[model samples]
Each structure stands twice: as structure tokens, then as C-alpha cells.
Target: MKDAPLTPPLCSTDAVLATLPAGAGDLPGAMIVWEGALYIGTAPGAGEGGHARILRLPWPGGGAVEPVYEGPEGSAVTGFAALDGSSDAGPALYAALAAPGGGLILQAKAGAGAFAPVTEPGLGEAARRWIGPLALWGGRLVAAAGRAAPLVGAIGSAELLIEADDGSGTWAALSEPGFGDPGNVAISLLTVLDGTLLAGTVNPARGFQLWQAGEDGAWEQRIVDGAHRHVASPALTACAAGEGELLLGSGGAAPTAADLPADAQPPELLGLDPATGWELIAGEPRFTPEGFKVPAALEGPGFGWVKTARICAILRDGATITAVLAATPQSARPFGLPEPGAARIWRSEDAGETFVEAAALPHPLVAAAAFDEGLLLAGLAGGKVRLRVAT
Candidate 1:
């Protein structure tokens, strides 16, 4: 039989946890639970453009929201990574910053201290303008350098891979796996799985390519060479119910000038096993996944199929894994969500092979993090937070 639906905890003076107040033009970006607190990154909203802020809030119960770091004006925190500090030290945190002239990488020691710019001085200039989110590989911090934001066109090129030495804070560019456009390739996704570092590039003109680093530190590249032009979500999660299986999520292409029907391109979830390679587990390129299929009863005016095309975030919950996804209109604004759109959660059993709609959330759920105690914290694009208890 179907079980009770998972819902967020009730918010009250005593039961409520800490909350961060987003200003008039502040959009929350990536969020992660680390070091006994909730860290959230905020991007400058429509009318407010400047340096972004990272706020830290004590977790589990209630506390004051404090600004851990305030970036320079005209910069935003693109992504964050938790460091595996040396045996003598506690874990640290790293933030990836996107600025007008170049990118910056900041590192903060444990205990929510001040963040310091760790990006090598000349490295950002050598790497074009912007840096994608940072990830860790074999104890090294990795970031992809790309061209600064384009006003009315697509970026033609980006740096392949750059690694920073955790001990010395020195940065060095690495040899490409020898794939994608030597000039125009930019990394669109970065994550780690079972100690292996996985990277995906943004090459809409030639299709998205996946790069993997093996134990020997060798890199291999594969092109998804399919109808989809990009891999919208690149995430890794493990299922604990049966023999552990690693699941990878990817799908959706940004609408290009050609004006393709994005609604028809749905995100796909794949499972990777060492014995085998990649196998499709959920979603089809041309059709919506069964669990997220929009019911006829909920259809309304301005309802577009954009949400199923992308998988936003994936988190583990008990015996199942939950994915929060959204669908919006094709004409929706790029930096923000449409007024009222569809953003919902889906639960998957059997390692993402199938899923069931768990709950529908406010539109444009941009970021999500799962706490240790079955609590889910999500950051919406409209400067709001959603909290839920995994059932």
C-alpha cells in the first residue's frame, strides 16, 4: 500500500529552526548542511546586483543567522565544497565566486571563520573570466574556468580543468582528456562518486561530454551524443536499501536560438556500477517520467513542460532517494522563476529506476540539502526557504 506523504515540520516559536532573512533583491543559491550549521549562498536578485553573501545558521533547533562571508561587489558565490582537512585539522569549506573580471576561490577553516581568497593571482586571468562550482578530487580542489557572462550571445570557449593544491594553495591547469572543442568547452557539472571525480562540459554545439578520473589519476572522456544538448543536473547519490548502487542524474538543454521544444526533452537518471557502465534507470528524452507526469487535472493556462526537463537536486532519504525538480514556461525569465509554476519532489526506489511523486513545493526550488536527522532544507529562487521531514 502507498505510505503517508512526507511533509515539512511545523514551524513555531519553539519548534522553529534558524531562518535567514533575504533582502528585497536577494536570491538564494546552493545550500549545504555542514559543521553543525546550515550554510546558504545568496545571489544578487534582479534589481540588486553586487557581491553575494553566505549566511550561516545554527541547525536542528534555533539560533541567530550570521553572515559568514560577504563577497566583493559585482561577485556571486556560484558553488561550495566541503574540505577533508588533514588528519590534524577539522574539515574546511570552500566557496566558488563569479565576478565581472575573473573568478575567485575562497577557503574558510572549520568553526565558521573568515574566508580567504585562495585563487592563485594570475590563474583567474589565464582561465578566461568565470569559474564553475568547485569540487574535490584526491584531496585537490577543482574548478573550471569559463568566459564571463555574455550579454546577448553564447560563450565560444572556456578552460578545461584546473586543480588547486590544498597544502600550498597553488593552482595549476591540467591537460584536457583530449575531448570537446579545444577552444569553446566549459565545464557544466562537477561531482565525486566513490572517490572518483566526474566532470561534464558545456558544449552545446558538439553535445555534452562526461569526464572521469580513475584511481591512477588518469582521465577518460565520453560524449553523451544524443538528442539533448546539455546535461542539466550532474549529481551522485547512493541507495542503501539493497546492494549499494551509485545513481547519476542528467538531462535538459537550455533553449538555444534555434528555439527547440524544451518541453519534450525530459531529464534522465542513470545508475553506474563498476562491473557495468551506465544504464538508463529513469526518464526518457522525449517523454516525461511516469512519476512526474503532470496530471490532466492540474493543467492550466501558461503551463509549460519545462520542469520535467531538469532535475534540480537529489538527496537520500531512508530506504529511498528523493529528487526535487521543477517545470516552468519556455518564456520564463532566466534568473528567476515564473510567478506561479510547478516545483515538486519525487521519491525513487530501486536506485532511481522508478519514482513516485512525493510532494509539490513552491515553484523554482533552486537548492536543497538533507540533514543528518531526516530533515530536508530547500532554498527557493524567490528568497524563501522550505523545510520538510523525510518520512
Candidate 2:
């Protein structure tokens, strides 16, 4: 997965920080920075409408724009994790909130001022309520609730992978809920990489699945549906680890069924290799149980178009990674959206091996950060939270 170039554009100053109209949070899922401050979290737009806040900003040196933490009306903060034991207030932080059957987790530190509720909402289960992604393994924290999607919050439909313990708000159930596959549905991403913990599901019947969790915690199931490139599950959103492998990023085609032909699958940039195998750096050219694959991007897969949806945020930065290339509301109302920007940016300075296609913007990042000079994006688009400061 390494031959393909021509895809460069990264200047960015197209910042907006907050312009989230309609009930305030058009979309801006979890991001973090802590001490020098740069929080960001907000989600709920389009039928859920908005009410999931947490914007701080003032990092590497930029200011004003506070909003703290509000969430409740239709809820949607969805994920964040830090934890460092008992909290003399330096690390701790958990947060989830997905509302509906009432899903919650909150808890903060690093000079904390607010963010409490240590879990009571759906942690016991009222159908689980969509709580996806948030990582940190054996030391606890973890997360990945379920109700899976549709009304967005959970009243039942399976999905659980819980953890928590370090600061003990007590939580368990490492798998079994949907791990037993009620057709999987929403585990979306948990990530640890390197030390390995990963869990990415979204199974719209039989596609997206990745799971991993050893060292006695059990849980395995490497890559099923997507290994077949059944691409559909928010185009397999994000996953990042690097070096030894595991840097998945498919552009979420977000269709859900309008005749579900795998929601028009088109978005790829994978490379897992090292156990269950499966490589394909671009997309389209399958045949796997771990065999054929091919495409390294000569504009193959969505990287070249067909509506570049999926890969909403990957972020790495040591050997350089940075993905994020969204486009979906069912591909902007029924077919091939690309014209006036839907969100774009793809890079890879050797970590994920290879990639290009840089900058196109208009919103669609979930979270990003990298500063020594600047590179801090927090997009959710139309629900606005846009802030791409690369200068």
C-alpha cells in the first residue's frame, strides 16, 4: 500500500471556532488537550438537532470561546478518555453522554471545575444508549455502549464493551452484549494501538467489525465484514496505531439504506497487516479473506472521488498521519457530492506508510490537534464548530 501521489493542499486559516446555529452544536465530536486548554465536543444536528457542548480553545496560543460543558437537550458528546489513577486533579476525565435511554459518564480533572456524573444513566442499561469510542485499556476507562443508531440513543439493540476502574466508578462487562452480534451495530471505535485494545463495529447487518482485547481481558474477532471490504459503517470511520500496523481510515459513506447496495461502498485506505492481515491502501479491488486487495491510490477508491465520504479524522503526527475526508448525508442528497467542498485532508509522512490528497475543507473533522506552529481542526460542519488553524 504505497504508490500514489498528487494530493496536496494544506494552508488552512479557514477557521470558525463556533458558528453553530440551530440550538448550537451542528457537530464537533470529542477532542482534547487538557492543561493549556483546547477541549471541544458537541454533536447533534439534523434530526437530533443539538445540545452536546464543551468547547474551550486557547492552546499553543489562541483565545476566547469558552462554553464549558452543557449537554442534555438531545445530547451527544459521545467520547473522551484520559484517566491517571486517583486524581489529585492532573489526568482523570471520561465523558460520554448520548441521551435518550439516558446514557452518561462524565468526570473531569486537570484542575477540574465541572463535569461530574460518574455514570448512572444507562450504564446499568435501559437499552444502553449510543456511547461509542473512548480509550485506555488495562488501566481501565474504555467505553462503547449500544442502542446503535436510528434514533441515535439506545432503548435496546445490543452493544457493550465497558471498563472503568482506575478511579473506580465501577464498571465491567467487557463484551457479550453485541459482541455476540445482534448484527453488531455501533461500537464505532475505541482505539489504543501499540499496546492494542481496539474495537470498531457498526455492522449494518454483516459488515464492520474489528475487536481486540487480550492480556486476559478476552475479546478477539479481528476483522470480519470489512475484511471483505463490505465498506459501510460510516465508511469505517477512523483507526490509528502506526509502525507495526493498524491505520485504517475509510470515508464513511453514511447511507443506511436507500436500497443498501452496501450504501454504495467507496472509501478506503487500510493496512492492518500483522495477525489477521488485510492491506489495500486505497480501495476497490477486493477478494479478501486476506488475499488479492491492491490499489495503493492512483485515485482508486474515494480518494479519487465517487464522493469522498469516510475517514473523518485519524491524526498521528510523529511520523505524520492526519486523515479526515468526509462527505455524507447520504452523499449530499442522493449522489456524487464534491463540488464546493464537503471536507478533505489526507496526509501521511511515512507512518501509515503512504498517502496524499491534502486540504479541501468546508467542515467535517471530528477532532484534531498538532501544534508547534499550528494544526488544530475540530469540525462537525453544518452544525458548525469549524476551527482549522494551520499557519
Candidate 3:
């Protein structure tokens, strides 16, 4: 793949419309923007010793962040979804929490002031595994569990749960035969596209793959051989309804025996067709900011060299797609814990064909979502959350 030139940088100076109050040590988790409000989930802050909480910040101009519920310590909020018109009580916010015992799912009204724990419909432990990556689709809540196994020769499985408007639901095991022999792959991310459930997985060699589920409970795999050079974890963002398109972001580079070139580009964003089993429509290695260079001397712990960085979060608005890149450059010598360069936000107006730097934040972004037209919300590693709006 050929490298592309860096485009003009977009500033977040006039874009930062507001900053809400978050806990001292809280880490941002899943976020969803719906019906004129921004809902955010948080993990335990550095010092805060309690279960994670869901906070809602009024949209358009609402400036305060308020907690909706608080659970046990180390119980982090992982996933979120807004239930359909099943209840007269308004929209229901479903959150996934990583607790000491497997995992927990909680449901609450959009503006009910608080969340009440509800037994997740159809939850079961086939072999006792950790559940994560939750998605709200077609008025139903779906979650997947990553089977715990050794680093090599590990396999993963997935389950689907459907919760009724009244909170009643059923759980069924998804047969993803395309994922080799079922127990050989691990599912990492789950999303919904065009009334179907989609999942991404990592093979033992770190290669990326995709799978989809139909209404009949049948799951099929979509493979894109040689689409990514190294490990490419899938990052799913929204697309126009009925368009049958999904945006995917990956930071893993093409496998290279030598260090990355000085002009090495960031991960490429691509469009996938869920109905056709995730056909690759378009993709390109994203570009870094102009004048932003990666030092050749930065490396990781033992190898004394940082291999590749990955894309963490993505926000798409119309034809424009923005990506947050976290890169760790390979270092020739260790400088006692490298700062890893500053994180950059890249924007592509024409799908993933080309890109330019949209913003530069001091720290790496852990999570991000499109707040509104020309507005973006970013949660950083240092427990800082900021809102970026058009100037």
C-alpha cells in the first residue's frame, strides 16, 4: 500500500462546547447519543471504590453530567443501548457491567432518575466465561462472552439474548461455524447492522475476521483475507439506516519483519456490507497530522521496539468519518517509559478514501461518540471528558 500525504488539521479550540463534571478516577465506557441527549457510562475512577455508573448530559446546551446509577467497586460499565417503544415509561437505557461474578446487565428509563437491576433475559454460562461487548438492536439487547482460555489455541463462542419491552427475554447460543471449529476463535466486538447482529474476532495469529447472525438464529462468517497487514481489531460505528453499510476501523499494520517506515500511516477505515457477509467496499491506511512525526527511537517493554498502534474509537457524520489513533513508535533505545506521542483525530470527508487531522488531544482517547451535528464527545485516559462542537 502506498502512503498518502497529510491533510490540513482541524482544531478543537472552537469545537469544545462544554465540559461536564465526572468522577475523579472514572474511565469513560460505552456512549450513545439519542433523542437529544448524550448517555455515557463510566468505570471506577482511580480513587472511587464502587461499581461503575451511567451518566446523562443534556444535549444541545445542557452542561451538567449527572449519575443515574452506581453499583459495586471495580464493576465497570461496558455497553449501552436504548430500547424501542416497548414501554410507556420512555426510552430504556441498558448497560453492561464487568463485575466479580461473570458480568451484569442493568436497565433504566431514559429520564427515570435512576436505574434498577433487572435479570438479563436468557443469560447462561455454557462453560463459565466472561461476558462483554453489548449492543442494542431491533428493540432487543444482545451480549457476547469471550471464552477464557490460554493465549495459544484459544477458541471463543457467542450467545444472543432478546429482552421484551417488559424486561422478559430469551437467550440462545449462536452457531458461528465459519469461525473454524467454534472453540478455536474468540469474539471481541459485537454490533447490529440492518436488523442483523455482527461480530468481530481474533484468531490465534492475531488476524481479524467478521461474522453475522440472521433472524433464523443462523450465524455465518465473512472473511477478508489480506485485508489487514497485522492484527486488525474491528471498531463499529453507525451508518445511514437501510444503506446496509457499516464503518470499521483498525490500527494494526501489515506484518513487517523490519521497523515501520518513518512515513508509516495509521490504521485504515473501511466500509462493510453486512448482508453480503461484510464485503469490503472501500479502505485506505489513514494519515497522521502534518508535521507530526514518529520518533524512530521509541519502543515497548522487552523488545525495545513498539510495533503497531490501533484505532480505538470512531465517529461518523454523513459522509464524514473521524477516527482516533493511538500509536506507539518503535524505539531503538528505551528512554525510561516513553510518553508515546500525542493522540490525533483524523477525518475523512469521502468515506475512507482520504483523511486529514481533525483535532489533536493531549492524551489518548479511550472512547468517543458523535454528540450532534458538528459536535463530538471524547473520553480520555486521564479521566478527562470534553465536548467538541463546530466553531
Candidate 4:
């Protein structure tokens, strides 16, 4: 019946598959399609303050865009996780460097060489500056240290829950720092549903907190007051579709279109149904704790776009699951399109209930991966530039 509206692919710039350099940023920063190639990862952007690199596109797309690993000019490259190694360590690829003496977690072995560090920066404290969304679940590797750059404004600390497990790169501190709430500084995001392992925090005073990781690993809070909305001031992007479902979104703040509607504040997408928990597949609804929800996503929330609200990427594809849109990218170059605003994409098929807007990209896409046979987009950025990084 309604199967005719699925033709949206050219993604702009001839389906760009490589564009990394010039600060490595456009918002989201961590794509993953290893070995054959496709490993972005960026954080610092906005001129002279951009260097957190890690590029290498070559798979299911075109090719020629290699940097591999570069962090250290101001460092960036927030998070990325991949580990099957299959033994003799034939598959590694783990990154999470926010640089400056309090963050690191490199390690890339089995083909696209060179990425060492293993642990030792923030794991040793140095202040726990920033480490990120890395998740693996029961086997190990579950990072989420503290403090981040949701654009530009970083200064909250203590948000642990960092683990590692035998690969020996050594990392431990399963949470005690902020979980004790130092205003719960940061845990940004981590995923894994169906085997359990969830965490999302960022507490700007009070807002954003979703924790669950048991079986003796201990950590159960699951959607505290923030889910009620402090503007979702913590939780960043997350994804764990299929089987019990899980997909939370929102970013405390810093996603402005010059203060849209008068003070910015619109970027939501929460839905966790372990049985009947938080609902509202998109933004703007009310009452939660499992009562009144009312938003099955009808082009609302950030989908009602204006930029940021923090969600740069959350794709699934197969059963359709996409949500990529972030602000602060005024592309005039660096792979094309995105000049005044335009880089949409939202899809959900029978899983999240409803959603459709598929493609509008010209870049500013942020991060996506599923390569080989198809799919490897990146940060095509958005429109409107001319600030020169003073934010």
C-alpha cells in the first residue's frame, strides 16, 4: 500500500564516501566499518581547534581519503568500538581519544595498522577529561569516562564506568565517580539491548540518566528524573534496536539556530520498553515513568530541525532505522552540500512505530556505516558559515 516512497539514495556529492580533514568535525564523530576500510572518528572542529583525526574511507564507496590516526593538535575522536579479534587478535579497532593528558584508548590491529595507547590516559585519572560511547556488553569493553565537547563548553568531571577485560590494555573503574552524582558530569552514551548494558548521562545540574548493567556487574537506575525532561540535559545518542528495544537521544543543550523559537530546547527521542518503561518515540510529549507519552514522531523534535540538540547519527538499515542530524556545519567545501541548512534523514520501519523522511543529505550526515555492499556516509555538514570558530 504505502511502499512507493522509498527512492531516496543519491545522498549528494555523488554519494560521497570520503571527506576527512579540515578539523575532522561536523558534529558526530565515529563511523565503523573496519578492515576493508571506513573508520572516521573526530571531535574537535571549528578551526584551529581541530585535529582529533582518524580517517580511512575505502569500502563500498569510492576510496582515497586516508589519515588513519592523527590526534594531538587539540585532539578529538571521541568514540568507536569493534572487537571480535576472533583470537590471535585479528580484529581490534577501538578509539576514544579526547586528548590533552586525560583521555586515550586507541588500539587498531589487524590491517589498518598504527593506533596504540591501549589505556593509561584518563584511566589513570589526569582528570578524566573525555572518553566515550564505547560499548561491547558481556564480553567487556564498556567505556564512558567524563567531560566532553558537545560543540564547545566542557568542564564537568567524574563520570566513570570504564572497563576492559583481559585484552589487557587494562582499564577498570566500573563507576563510582559521578554515578554518585557530582551533578553526574558525563557518560554520554553506550548501547546494547537484548543482553543488557545501557548508560547515558550528562547531567547539566539534573537531567539525563539511564543506567542498567547487571548480572553482578551492578548498575541499575534506568531513566531517572531527567527522562522527565530537564531538557534531557545529559543522554546523548544511543541505539540498540530489535529485541526489547532501546533508542534514547538528546544532548543537554548546544544545538542552536540562533536560539530558535526563542531559547532553543528541542531534541528528544526516547523509547525503552524492557517491559514498559520510557516512551515517546520523538520529541515533545509529557508525563513519563510510563504513563502519558503521545509522540510517535510526526516530524516533531529536532526532526523539526534547527540543528544540534545532539544526535548526529543513529542508523540501522535492514529493518530501517536512521536518525542523523546535528548542527554546526556550514559546508561550503569538504565533500559538498550543506550551506544554509539541509541534511535530513529519519526512518523507522515497524520497529519504532513510525517515521519517514529518508534523505536530504548533501553532507552534514555525521557518521554511518554498514559498508561493503552499500552505505558509508559522513559529516556533510549543514548550511550557514562565517563565524570562524570563536564559539
Candidate 5:
């Protein structure tokens, strides 16, 4: 595909509207867009105890980001899901909290005072390391938990908990031995497509693979085999069924001493057909130049590579996807470091075919969500947040 000129005015960049009030020290964990508001969760920052809190930013911009729930100190929120209430249940938000002792999944209704913990029935005292990438599929809340056991080694596993309208749920393991080795991989992303739950993992031997769980609770896995023995991790998002594709961002495996002179391998973005157990449909060119270290979100026109200072976050608006590129420069060569880098917005409307420079941003963007009014809510490094609307 022919590359588009790095043009300007395809998008706009705005200033920081709200700086999340950092308690003594806090690290932003997860940010999501739901119900016309921006929800942010913070983990413990430097010198601060690990305390988890949920902050809500109302719509229409220019408002205070307040903490709705302040949990015990040292508790970290790793995942979040917005739940639409059923006949017996009311609208609520589901969150996964990772504490030092163990992890717990809690549900908080819209009007309810506080969140109530949902116990994982039949799950005994299993070790929980990280709780995240939560998904709500077919009346069940699914999440990945890294279990650390003395003899079993570290295993990345998934659990499906029955989410009843009455706030009662039951849990079952989705990663059992016979199917295949769960290995010691981390489940980075999870999504529900066409009544099936899809999970992306970074495993030891397989590099990256997409695992699917059907409505009947059966699981199947498909490895995204790349040319020249490459490692890939699947990142999934829900679009218009056929248009929705799985993104395999490159990372994890680094070149060894013997492979120094060799060129750094770029990551491949593979499109999957969800119904057929993640069948590889098409493979796009490795968007980010090789050896760039961490290649962040594939944003803008969705086609070509938008080399940024440091990729902070990626947001898609209509057919265009905007990449929040940070301005961090590196001294290392072979990584294709940006020259005179600064934070800016790069957009692509052709599905990774081409890209153009959009707008200049103040801080490094970490996360962004497209709002209904054509506005983009962006979370930046150092607890800064901004809103970028169409010019």
C-alpha cells in the first residue's frame, strides 16, 4: 500500500482537562469509556501503599474526577466491566481487585452505596497473582488469573463465574490440563464476539495464541503462526462482527547474543474469523519498524505505520484510528528512534494502510476512548487527562 503524506488537520489535540488528584502516590491502572463518562482506576505509585480506587469523570467535559470507592490500602484494580442489569438486578459495574493476600471480583450497582464481593464458588484457596482482562460473556463473567503454586509452577488460567441478577455467581476453571498446557503465559486481552469468549495469551513456547470459549463452555486454541518463526500476542476488540479483527502486537522475545547482527523482527497484525475458532484471514505488514523496542497501538487510518516518540495509547474514531504517540527519545540504535520526538497524534483511516500526522499533544498519552459526540477522552502519563474533539 502506498504511504500517505504526513498531513495535518485530520484530527485535533486538546489540553489536559483534569489531572487525577494523586493521593500521596498513585499509578493509573485501567481507564475505560462507558455511559458517557470516563472511569479510571489507580494502583499504588512510588512510595505509596497499594490502594485501589475508582474515579469517575462525568460527560460534557470540565468536571472534577472524584473517587467513588476507596478500597483498602495496597489493593489494586486490574480489570473492570460495565454490567447491564437484568430483571432482578440493577445496572452495576464489575471490577477485579488484586490484593497482596488474594484477588477478589466485586460488583457495584449504580445507586447502591458500595460494591459487594462475588465469591467464586467451588474455587478453593488457589494462589492469585494478577487478575485482569475481564469479560462478560453469555451471562458469565470471565477473567484471567495468574496462579502461583509451589509445585504447579506459574500458570495463566481463566475462570467463568455465573453472574446472576441477584448478585450471586459461581466460578469454574476454563484452563484444564487435557485440552493443552495453559503454560506460564499472561492473558493480556479478552473479548466476547458472537456469543463466544476470545482470549489472547503470551505463552512460553507458542509465543502468542487466541483461545476461544463457546457457549457450551468448551475451549479451543489457535496459534497465529508467523513467517520465519515469530512470536505474537493477540489483542482483540469488538467491531461490526466481520470488521472486528484480532491485533497481534510484537514483543516478549528479544534477540540473543548470536542474533545481534540480524534485523529486529516486526510484529504481525492478523485478522481472525471468530466463528471458525480464530481462523487467520489476512496478515498485514509489520507496521512498526523493526527493533523499535515496544510498538504500541496501531492507530489512525489503521493501515500504515505511524512512528511516534513513544506509543502511549491508541484510539479509533469511525474509520480512523488515532495513536497517542509519546515524545520519549532513546539512545539505542537499530530501534528506529524518532528524531526530535515530542508527543503528537497520528491517524490512519485505511485500516493500517497509510497514516498522517494529526495534532500535537502536551503530555504522553497512555489511554484514549472515543466518545459519542466525536470527542476523545485521553489519559496521559503522570495522571493527566484530556479531551480532543474534531476541529
Candidate 6:
């Protein structure tokens, strides 16, 4: 085995977009390039309390930043998604805000109108429920909101909700734990592949489960990992190499115990086919690249993982898929990314068979996008954004 370099940089950060002013929210979340603008949602940063901000930067220059939405206290933007305009509902942007002491999902017209809450009544207990990512499935906006953190006793539950894009108030619970897994407490990811909606969950008792549903709302569940106490399997992206294929990233962990330390099991990357089920891509890791050492915690069978950063965003360029990773600590604090440096970007050539660290961004990376001018936009921690010109 060749020795891997200690610190390898992947892409070069060449330009700066905008730096947040003092008291502005820092951690950026779900980002979507819709119409001709790039929309970025943010989470509360240090000393901000519970405030969140949504910024819009135009494409060509992407210099002038517009505060699309400035949320009130106790509000943090969690996710964002865009719906292509139709005859009924014009193009609109949806945001999932961690409010309600629990979570709230909101929507607004593409380029006009202010964001308004669209969450259903009596979904879960306040302060405990939180919504995961958002996606548009079969013309309807969909998201998962459930009970995740508890003050005491057992953790609560989660459910999938659907709302029309035409500004109607028809909010409904598409499915519940009774409709799927009773132990699913948090829905981490909601994505579409081959016209099917895929959902990933974080389960405390049963690890994580991946669910697939059609337009009719019938869901089929599959257990992907069951060894860890909390399986933070939220990252999901399409495979550009193969048609209708999907890649799922799992952040596994074993709860703190007397003899066992709170092990941050390296994130797992799995590939799913329309025909075959979920297949472990890095189950038997080669650790081929030099200077990359398999951490002592990730050394056993099916544990030889490469990327330790939690999967944030996956960008597919041609046949190569780039996985953007973040280092969120186990203490549950926000943006544990190192100072003066950023997160790692890993590239895979043959699907998920292997991954090589490509480049590094300045500051911890929360979201990324490819611009029309052949530049990559990376949203970093501390309200800073930059552009990566080349790989």
C-alpha cells in the first residue's frame, strides 16, 4: 500500500462571493439554483440565538447578495427546494424551518411573495419534532417532520407530510410510523430517483431504514444499517454514471457506554439500483491512496471507510460524483469545521467502488452548486461563501 499524504487539497478556492455581516446567521443548509438565482438557507450561528437568514445571489455576477427572508427569533432555516412553475402554481421556493419548538415547513412563490408556514396541525409535540429535508414528488411538495429529541423518556416519532404547490391549504399526512417503521424518529433525507421518492431515517433503536414510495404514497421499507444507536443517514444523491441509480451516505454511531466509547463510525457510502437492492460500495475498502490511514475506530470488516466527514452535498459532473463532507462533532454543536481551512471533497470514478480526496474548501462546507460560468459555489461556515474555479 502506498503512503497517503497527510493533508491533500482537492479544488482551489479562487473567489469570494459574500461574507456575512456581524450578527448574521452562519451555517448554510439546503441550497438550490432556481430560475436565474441561487437560493441559500441558513441555520443559527453562535450568539445568534434562534435566528436564520435566506440569501439570494444572481447568477452571472453572484456578487450582490439579497436578503430574501429574514426569520424571527427561535427560527432556523433547515432546508430548501424549488418547484417548477405550472399552470396552477407558479414556480415557487419551499423552506423547512426548525421552528414550532419542533419544526415547520413553509413555501413561497419562486421570485415573489414572502415565505409562509404550511405545516399541518397536531403533527407532533412541540420542542421535540423536527423536519428533515424537502423534495417535490409527483407535483406535490413533500417533507418529513417528527419527534427527535426528548427531555426525558423514549424518543418520539416521525411522519411524512404532503402539500400542494398551488398555494392551497391542503396539508395532509401521507404516511406515519404505523404506516412504516414505528421506531423511525427522524427523517434525514428526502430525494427522488427514477420518479420514485426515497426517504432515509435516523433510528435510535433500529439503526436506519430507507423507504421508497410511489405517486400513490405506498411505502416499502428496507433496513440498511442496524448496528449503531443513531444512524444519521440523510445524504442522498443521484448517480450520473448509471441511469436511475442512487447513492446514500450513512453517518453511524454507537451511543456512549461504560466500556464502549461514543464511536463515530466513519460514514458509509452505499449504492442502490432500480433492480438490485442496496449494495455496500466501500464495505471492503482498499485504502489504496497513499497517506490515507484507516482510523483506529474504522478498521474492521465493512468499516474500512475513507471519508470521515459527514456527507453534506454530492455534485455529479459527467461520470464523476463529488461528495462534499462536513465534520459535525458528536456533541451536536454546529459546524465543527476547522478554522483557516475547510471540509474535504472526495471524488469517485467508478461509482462508489472507491473515493479519493480531491480538494478542500475554505471554512466548513455546508452546501455547493455548479454555476453556468463553469465555477463551483461553496457555502461555508461563519456566513462566508466562495467560488472554486478548478478541481
Q: What is the C-alpha RMSD of each candidate to the true structure, in Å?
A: 7.2, 18.6, 9.0, 18.3, 7.9, 7.4
- lDDT of every predicted structure (CA atoms): 0.52, 0.62, 0.50, 0.60, 0.48, 0.54
TM-score for candidate 3:
0.71
Residue 6 alpha-carbon offset, candidate 5, angstroms: 13
Per-residue error for 131 in candidate 2, Å, reads 3.6
Instruction: Give one digit per residue, the lDDT tens place, for model 4 in 249-356.
Output: 674343222211223355677768877687767776677656777777655677666554455455554565666554534432356444443445566776557877
Write the residue-wise lDDT of candidate 1 on 112-198 in tens digits: 477888775324473355665677776777776666532114552445455654565556665452244552345656777767666
**Candidate 3 C-alpha lDDT tens digits along 193-269:** 66677776544344556667767766665543324433333222222222346766554321110112233334444
**Poorly placed runs, candidate 5 (over 4 Å):** 1-9, 46-48, 120-126, 148-168, 177-179, 182-184, 225-229, 232-268, 275-318, 323-345, 360-362, 369-391
CA shift at 242, candidate 4, in angstroms? 31
lDDT of 1: 0.52
Backbone clashes in model 3: 17
> Model 4: runs farther than 4 Å from truth?
1-39, 42-53, 56-66, 70-104, 107-114, 119-169, 173-198, 201-209, 212-287, 290-310, 313-342, 345-360, 363-391
Per-candidate TM-scores read: 0.74, 0.32, 0.71, 0.31, 0.70, 0.75
lDDT of 2 by residue, 1-391 (tens): 2112212445454544444334563466666666677676776655656588876767756567677788778777766777775544447777787777667878776676568767777677656666656776656666777664532332345455555545556567787876786665566667777677877776655667777778786788777886675635333566666566777865443312111232445567776865757577767776776677776544467677665556655665567766666554333455655345555676767664566766765544455544444556665445445466654
Query: Which residue pairs show collisions in model 1?
Result: 8-388, 157-184, 307-326, 307-327
Q: Which residue runs does candidate 6 get wrong by more than 4 Å?
A: 1-10, 46-48, 118-129, 148-154, 164-168, 178-180, 214-216, 226-242, 252-262, 284-309, 328-342, 366-391
Q: Tens-digit lDDT track for model 6 on 226-268?
A: 3122333322322222445676555532110000112434455
> Any idea what lDDT model 5 has?
0.48
Instruction: Look at candidate 6 and tell me the lDDT of residue 29.
Output: 55
Please report, as a residue range, the 10-residue window in candidate 4 with the lowest summed lDDT: 382-391
